[model samples]
Target: MSTANERARMTDLALQEWGVVVGILAERGESWPDTDVTRWGPGVTAAMERTRALCAACSIVGATEAADIGRLADLYEARTRS
Candidate 1:
């Protein structure tokens, strides 16, 4: 039920957080741990699902782009978390 602007802000925040995590992972040259699947997986999955729904409802191309950015963030979160 978020407005477009709110969704955009959320997407930006997610991307920023993901970028930091990815940078750390790259520097470590190590994959993330998989044992804690229950912790990160559900959150990432929910984020992606929300992002996809937001993309579908987006009225502006920019909003769609923001959603795409959010998707990338979710991808990074999933990859780095496991």
Candidate 2:
């Protein structure tokens, strides 16, 4: 079994990873055209909120790994960046 300190450390790392994902998502949202923003903006915002919720709830272990989140952030940046 993991100690409380280890769990806390994992949570912190997960939140940091989520933060990177959120930032990339925000950048992706900013790149959307105004016409399509109406339809897509809410979805992006929801995704951001969900990540924050996951971090707040401290669901790190089997939920999502930091490396996975980093990969996702990288994918978002690559696909959305100009």
Q: Output the number of the TM-score-best candidate.
A: 1
Q: In model 2, how large is the Cα lDDT of residue 79?
A: 48
Identify the runs in model 1 with alpha carbons over 4 angstroms from their true place: 31-70, 73-82
1-82, model 2: which lDDT tens digit per residue? 5567765576565555555546655566643123243555665666556655655444444333323444434534554475
Q: lDDT at 16 for candidate 1? A: 58
Report the C-alpha displacement of residue 73, candidate 2, in angstroms: 14
| Cα RMSD to the true fold for all candidates | 8.3, 9.2
For model 1, how does the per-residue alpha-carbon lDDT over 14-50 read when each residue is reduced to its tens digit?
Answer: 5555465445544546334422334444445465455
The local distance difference test score of model 1 is 0.51
Model 1 residue 12 CA deviation (Å) reads 0.6
Q: 44 in model 1: Cα distance from truth in Å?
A: 15
Candidate 2: regions farther than 4 A off: 30-82
- The global C-alpha lDDT for each of the candidates, from Candidate 1 onward, is 0.51, 0.51
